[model samples]
Target: MSQETEPEPSPGPKQENGPTTTGSFLCLHTSPPLHIALHGMSALTHTRLSRTAFDLCLELLEAGVKPQALADIVVHILEFKEQFN
Candidate 1:
């Protein structure tokens, strides 16, 4: 997938696997294209999990994951989360 170069995120607490509710997820409040630009292919996956690909990508971008690397990271996050669940 195409990569977007971004910066690293500041250290903070990590998240856990959980179900998503409309009130719990992020970016859903924003315009669809903006959401798509940020989350890409992982949009639905993150939404279903009560997670936010946009939020994840922002954090990943801050962590130097780069925009282009987001899709891959989302894929990895999803796979990893699914592996144990």
Candidate 2:
């Protein structure tokens, strides 16, 4: 059986003059499991949970899991919760 691979995120245009303004910034793609996890947590009314989720994604990346896998994990979690709860 062949394992599916996630597509690489496109690197948007580089800014010649350095960082662009925050409002104009685009997050075209993110690592999967972690990204999905963070996005789900972001819906909560609690600020701490949201921040923690973001931090978790960063830590996962540091640990060397592919971003797409992290996103997929997040998606899996959310789906599991929906089915069970």
TM-score of each: 0.32, 0.39
Q: Write the per-residue lDDT of candidate 1 for residues 1-85, one digit (tens) a residue.
A: 9999888988888664343233323323335564556465556444444345456554455455555577676668878988999
Compare the candidates by lDDT and give the number of the best one: 2
Worst 10 residues of 2 by lDDT: 19-28
Candidate 1 clash figure, as a count: 13
Q: Candidates' lDDT values, in order?
A: 0.55, 0.59
Q: Tens digits of per-residue lDDT for model 2 on 1-85?
A: 9999999999999755432222333231334564566566666633333456666765666666677898788778767777997
The segments of candidate 1 whose C-alpha lies over 4 angstroms from its true place after superposition are 1-53, 58-65
Using TM-score as the measure, the top candidate is 2
